[model samples]
Target: MSLFWSIYVGVLVTSNLGLAIFLYIYGTRVKIPIEGDGTTGHSWDNGHLRESVRRLPRWWAMMSLTSIVVAIGYLILFPGFGNYKGLLGWTSEQQVSEARVANAQKLDQMFARYRQYPVNQLAGDSTARQYGNRLFQDNCAACHGTRAEGGHGFPALTVNGDDGDFVVSTALAGRTGVMPPWGAVLGEQGVTDVANYVLSLSGAPHDAARAQAGEPRFKETCAACHGAEGKGTKALGAPDLTDHSWIYGGDLASVEQSIRDGRTGHMPAWKDRLGEDQLRLIAAWLRYNALTEREASIAAPVADARR
Candidate 1:
């Protein structure tokens, strides 16, 4: 508080306490002349009432004295007095700092153990998995969904799955997948043909000759980033076209539009937002989920494929 406010507060507090003390003391000892009728001479209500003079009740006096002493003790021990900062010298900043230290110490112990395991190995750990799950839910769930299954414009993590290096590389730094719009360059027919070709590469249904026709154009324009086979360059974060996974959509029209115009999906860097330790834990869980699901996919080839 400024000197003026501090002094103002001090004066008010002092006056309040002083008044209470004076009243307590005076109430007990003030004397009044009493008549034989056991009443003070003061009368009211047209003489129907006469005031009775008596000692302050012992209980009330004791309570008031206790309250005064407690208030004074509080002012001395804590921060009630203006600008004094109290005898304890406590501050909210100091308390928070102390709490942060304790919290860091606890987390450091858990993180130390986590560090021993690679992101892959940590996926198997129950404690790490539990922590990783919680961490992912808090940070990644908004975009990736509660189950990490992903949504429109976001890559499906569980579907066909990408390899560890691909996933980790994207997670660590983050990546923006850009398929620049080719609509203006390729006429409507060319866009449809190229989309069929991309679909054909993954063994999805397409007019084979049309797909073959589209290849020359695809090689001329798309091969550099998407690669000769359309499996995509992981280094470039060009998605594997051979995979069934699709970011925009896997349908025929969706693929055509993608080929004609293109699309971009941006995953922001979580490192600073979530902190290193937390991001690492979430990364661990994603790594775990990816590996387990990929294995299961291979083991159970789509039933239709078996035929």
Candidate 2:
């Protein structure tokens, strides 16, 4: 603290403590004059009530003295007195630092057991999954929904066929996917045609004539990132065009805007914020959810056949 502020605080503290001490001492020792009726010359409600002075109660006096002593002791042993470092030389920052170190050590011990298993295998462990789910909710749930179902402008985690290693690596390093604008090159009509053709790839509704016209153009231009079959390249983070999944909406206008204006999607790297073990835990939970969804999908077909 600045010298002026420190001295100001010290003065304020000393003045307050002095006033309290003075009040305590004077209150107990000072005597007040009283009438023969033993009441002070004060009354209310047509003299039904009258004020009287009495000695300070013994218990109240003792408690007040104790509180004063404790306050002085606290000031001497702690940093309450302005810039005094205190006899113990303790600091709030030091306390927080020590707490963080202790917490990290405890986490390390817990994660040690998890290190033995690969992320895929770790997904099968209920305890690990519980931790993973909590971690995912804390870190990943904002972009990927609580259920990992994704939202507009965000890819769904559950549907991605990514394995644990891929998930972990991506989380650690991050990824950026850029779809360059083809509006100027493709012209207005060409943009509409290509959008329709892209929709056709996913079996979404589209004009047949426009789709046919845009096929050659799509193969020539878009096939580099989105495969000729429109299945996407995972390495490039290009979403699979053949699937129902759409980072933006799957509607016709949305697809046209994407082709014309382009889109950029970013997944932030977590290496600085989260350790590898924590990332692996998140990957494991995601894998578990994906597997569970796949199993349910498979069973639904079998049950439908029986019905």
lDDT against the true structure, per candidate, is 0.79, 0.91
Per-residue lDDT value at 79 in model 2: 97
**Model 1 misplaced stretches (Cα beyond 4 Å):** 1-71, 80-82, 159-169, 202-210, 296-307
lDDT of 2 by residue, 24-70 (tens): 99999998988889988799999999998788899999999999999
User: Measured by TM-score, how close is model 2 to the native structure?
Assistant: 0.93
Model 1 has an lDDT value of: 0.79
- Between which residue pairs do clashes occur in model 1? 181-261, 183-260
Per-model TM-score versus the true fold: 0.72, 0.93
Residue 125 alpha-carbon offset, candidate 2, angstroms: 1.6
Each candidate's clash count: 2, 0
lDDT of 2 at 60: 96
Q: After superposition, how far is residue 112 of candidate 2 from its true place, in Å?
A: 1.0
Cα lDDT tens digits for candidate 1, 107-148: 998798877666667667778878978987887788878777
